[model samples]
Target: MSKLTPLGSLPYPQPTDVADVPLHLQSLAEAIDGRTVLRFTDIANLQARVTNPVAGMVAWLGTPGRLFHYAGNHWAPVAPGPVHKVNNNEGSTTSTTFVETLTSATGDPMAVSFTAPPSGSVIVTVGAYTYNSAADGLAYMSAAVRLGTTVKLAAHEDRSSIVRSAARVSASTQFQVSGLTGGALHTVTPAYRAGGGAGNTASFDNRFVRIDPVT
Candidate 1:
């Protein structure tokens, strides 16, 4: 029986421990640097071909997001469509207070004609503002929709005279005006007075929305 012996093991040179070597396989402090940094060969290429690139952009880079920094550094929810402003300044003019007293054909008089939400009837908010400081115009004057002889909604004070000066508030908003009889021969009585005389003309431009009946 021939004695079986293990094949001679090749003795290869062993690499020395780099822990004691100064610059042998050891990364230099200058190469590492104190500041943390990530090297990228081609950012745009990686982004274009990267998986879930859109998600990466949203997470890493502040881009391709719906939110925006509109007013300040804080992020705000972006509106999908155009923003609608309910009111705007109509300017001021030297004029008298134009008071209109609306009457119901049956003898009950009211200012506005809004009863239901979807109805064509709308409530109007009339505000009086200063026209000219030189004219000593009224500072603040306002009124709201009145349904009948007794009911007055959103009542505000006329802090200053509305006649013979530039009115500060020429803006108005539409509200639902209802609860009164419709098609009752509504009549409106217009009256105004300037600072000097009863015949003085007062002018005011109001902002109003067109009434559309919803079926």
Candidate 2:
């Protein structure tokens, strides 16, 4: 009997087969990866090519070239299309504590301006910073999120730690807004309010905000 063997590398290899014409006497990786990249016009055509496919086998659809993995006797989509994001982080502003609420833009106008991603929801976070002695812990800093004058989210946190330093926090608040129209420029801003009307000044640290899509 003549012993079968693979005499060359794949994609154009010579094989003296023991029944597996394209995979005879090949290495483990070559034997598995060599003969399993099946191509077809679509799902229907793929079914016509092989009556039974082993689990994990892939089919590359010819029309759009999307890949699918076989499982539970069916081919399922195996690729995540894409992800998108939007951000705004710039400038700085102080806070004026009073009986009224404040917008994020007033503190740091640049850090609050962002364009919404096409027709998708976004997760937003805003930060309120305070510069205190850590002992004057009497200073209360609050931050809020707004889109073109619409208040989407708002929250407040307090800590008088003046330790003669600045601190940043989310004030235990976050927002998730949906139904964004594609290509629309929405101005996002973060504003702040301290304890005393003009008496309480929020330093630049209180004006930080971030926004990103939920996709």
Candidate 3:
């Protein structure tokens, strides 16, 4: 009697089975390594600064914005100076004072972000509200850009104030701007509460994000 193997071939240490050897050859698959990969250098950053604007435009890229810090927030030339940095609330707050400088006593809050404007332009949106203690009211606010006492850019009634709780529900306004530079001095233009801080606690988050190039 002969011993049998699983494939009808005699079992051997390394499959040296002799009983079931094929007369002809069979296609064998080559062993493949575990991973595939690729890599390349990033050129977008340098391309714009070095290459012509037309070439950068062909790639659908635009000139980068001027970056700077102001009024306790980060700003970029992309949106003039209305946008804000991550920690817009340089300080904390916990009050109902109708003050513009968002602080803890006046409700430190964050502003929603906006799209960057085309080169040489800035824009911001704001709403207005009445200084009511119990419920929110419709009041107007102003956004102005200034440089050492000189108002370089101005947008009125751009953003509206809201009850700390209602801010998430209300729609935001936008301020359009042009003729500004990242190197210039600027601020959110300011939002003045018409009446005054009502007993009701209304908070404001005038923070914004600006996107542009690094120069």
lDDT of each: 0.30, 0.47, 0.36
Q: Candidate 1 — what's its lDDT?
A: 0.30
Candidate 3: list runs displaced more than 4 Å: 1-83, 86-99, 103-119, 125-132, 139-142, 158-170, 181-185, 189-201, 205-215
Question: Per-residue lDDT tens digits of candidate 1, residues 30-138?
Answer: 2323122222233333345333322112112233223321212211223222111122323332344433321111211223332222222433333332244435433
Q: Write the per-residue lDDT of candidate 2 for residues 1-215, one digit (tens) a residue.
A: 23324653333334543456445334445545625777899777988877877777887988557786676445655552332222233223234342223334333333344445544466665444444323232344334445566665543343112222345433423567677543244544444444333343444343345666554
The count of backbone overlaps in candidate 1 is 14
Q: 1 or 3: which has the higher TM-score?
A: 3
Candidate 1 regions exceeding 4 Å error are 1-110, 117-124, 127-134, 139-141, 158-202, 206-215
Clashes of 2: 20
TM per candidate comes to 0.24, 0.36, 0.36
lDDT (10s digit) by residue, model 3, range 1-215: 23334652442323443434342112111111101111112224533333332211112123333332221122223224344443334222234223445445233323233333334455555543223333443334445555556666543443443333333333345545666554443454444443334444343343433323223
